[model samples]
Target: MSLRTRFTEELKAAMRAGDSARVSTLRMITAKLKDTDIAARKAPTDPGVSEEQIVAMLRAMAKSRAESVALYRQGNREELAAKEEAEIAVIESFLPQQLDEAAMAAAIDAAVAETGAASIKDMGKVMAALKAKHAAVLDMAKAGPMVKARLGG
Candidate 1:
């Protein structure tokens, strides 16, 4: 099934299961996606967001919750931090499996080679290639510095 269809099905399941946390997180995702769709509608010729875009949106939501977790922990709000952690778990359930250290390194190297990135000046090209190929699983934040280091030295 498409990501959007899966999200809808999962939302209904969560509602039936009375899983409030999952329900809320899924609702938030749907809302965000709907908002994106509405925004894109302004451009009549523009294709609606793709499955990859949906995955990127979900990753962004999870990253936001991760940030919230850090802030809650720093403020000594253990309960809130735990709640954010739970939300992250629910959000990630829909995302692809993330790459580990070794896999990430191999992917980066492959991207660099594929893009023929020879120096730091070509970092953007390499990063773009990696993001295109692995948007669902690669952590761009971590990959950026790794790509830069690989190209710089």
Candidate 2:
């Protein structure tokens, strides 16, 4: 099922089951999706966001939570950090299955080879290739340096 369909059903289940925390988290996701859909309408695409865009939104939400978790931990707020971690788990539910380390390395290798990326200047080509095929699977921030290293950039 699409992420939206599953999320709608899950929201209903959470409500019926009195899962307050889960319900709140799901509501946050739906709200974020609504905002994304509205933003996409202003662009050259469809009236609403696509599944791909939704995945990107989810990744952004997850990244934000990760940063919050780090901040909470640094502030010695374990309880708050745990909450952020839980929210991250909720946000991650909508993402495509992530690429394992081996899979990511292999895919990066292929993209480097395919683009004949010999130097750092070709980083854009490698990034574009990876984004096209693996946007929802790979963590681009972490992958950037790896790709650069492979290209001797």
Query: Against the true structure, whose TM-score is highest?
Result: 2
Query: Residue by residue across 28-107, what tens digits does model 1's lDDT show?
Result: 88899988887768677766798887888888888899999999999999999998898889888889998998999999
By lDDT, the best candidate is 1
Q: In candidate 2, which residue ranges exceed 4 Å CA deviation?
A: 42-47
Candidate 2, residues 1-153, lDDT tens digits: the string is: 988888899999999999988899999999888878877687666658778888888888989999999999999999999988988998887787888878988999999999998889999999999999888889888789889888887
Model 1's lDDT to the true fold? Answer: 0.89
State the TM-score for model 1.
Answer: 0.88
Task: List candidate 1 segments past 4 Å from native.
Answer: 43-47
Total clashes in model 2, counting residue pairs 3 or more apart in sequence or in different chains? 0
